[model samples]
Target: MSDVLLFSAGLDSFPAWHYLDKPPALYFDLGHRYRDQERAAITALVDRCGIEVSVSRELDLSRWEADNAIIPLRNVYLAMLAANRAERIWCVGVKGDATADKSPQAFRQISQMITDLSGRPVWLDSPFWQMTKTEIVAWYLGQGLPAGNLLLTFSCSRTDSAATHCGRCSSCLRRWISLVNNGIDAPFETDPWTWARVADYYVPAMRDGTYPDHRAEEFFAALDAVGFVPPPPAHPATAEDGQR
Candidate 1:
């Protein structure tokens, strides 16, 4: 039996795809707004890497908000599905993440749950658990993977009508920061915002209850050194709109 990878065509999965001899991959749509964009990226990567992929188109969007693309217990579904196809499953659970499902404890518990139900020991592995996103990209670069392959990955939380990265979303911001910090000049367009403005927008929203200020504050805070804006009085009146 071969290993099954819960692939998302992003930085986390890139190294796994390169190192793992083209493991079978599974992609979940989960009714996300950027699902089409994700699929296109995945298709391009697959064409380049020659890996087999299975796509799951989700029908129900009722479980989560349309704007916020997190599905509750998504890892559980992925693990169980992977267990059905292979005894060993691979995922990218990196360091310092708030998501409870991606934790080591959660992975162990899910492995046990899969074994109990399937009557077979299913191995759930995350090789990049100890590495950060920047480290992972560095590893990929050192491996001589074409830098052009980097453009095939997508990490935007929100998508426009054209299925492009919103760039203002937390995911886009973090991806941009990771690439820039790693010395890769990413050619993606995101809405411009300074770290100060991100805090100014989210901190008050946390108080007034307009935006879900969970990752917004934390991500922007992480980008303190690298956050680049137009610098000073770019839009004094519409600074609020820049947060969007």
Candidate 2:
């Protein structure tokens, strides 16, 4: 059985392709709001790298995460679809992710469900599950590949071009945190630190240890590089404020 990645041409999955020794990749065009941008980014990357990846069309999973940035059961849908291509499926999730559908426990459960239903051995996993996005980016650049190509990867909540990211969005903020921590300052239409969430939410939340320590360390370091500072530790944002 072959290994297939549920590729999205984003920060996480793009590096995952390399970490997995360049496995065959599968991208689903869910016709979401950012599909056009995502498809374009993927096309650019694959064409540049000559990667063995293909797109599956017309599977519209739009509006699932339109209002809120979190895509509900997104990994579940992707895992099930990927099983059709390979009994061994690779879905890239990062450290500190215990999302309902993207955690290690969740992946094991998906694998069991798929195996039982198909009566065929199926296993879904994320090699980067234990690695934070910053660590993953460092690993990717450490591969000695041309770093410029990584700029082609897309991670934006709103529409973004291959060259510029909308810095205000959570996806953009996350991407900036990872890339900046790796000393790769990507192009953003607005400085990610200027995204009000950095001051109003993330700063305090990260300081209070609402996020994993490793992640918080990287997050603060990235912001510090850009001259952003958090409030006093005593005034940390409560975890109940939620991750926005």
Shift in Å, residue 26, candidate 2: 0.4
Task: Judge candidate 1 at residue 69 and give its lDDT.
Answer: 68
Residue 116 CA error for candidate 1 (Å)? 1.1
How would you encode candidate 2's per-residue C-alpha lDDT over 104-151 as one tens digit per residue?
999999999999999999999999977998888889889897778889
Candidate 1 wrongly placed segments (more than 4 Å): 58-62, 191-197, 201-244
For 1-244, candidate 1 gives per-residue lDDT tens digits of 6688888898778677776766788887776677778888899988987868898764444356445667777788778877878888998876655476787778888899889988889978787777667667778888888888887798876646455656667677667656765667675565434435455664445445463343344344445545543223233458678778
- Judge candidate 1 at residue 95 and give its lDDT: 63
**Local distance difference test values of all predictions, in order:** 0.71, 0.85
**Per-candidate count of clashing residue pairs (backbone under 3 Å):** 0, 0
- What is model 2's C-alpha RMSD? 5.0
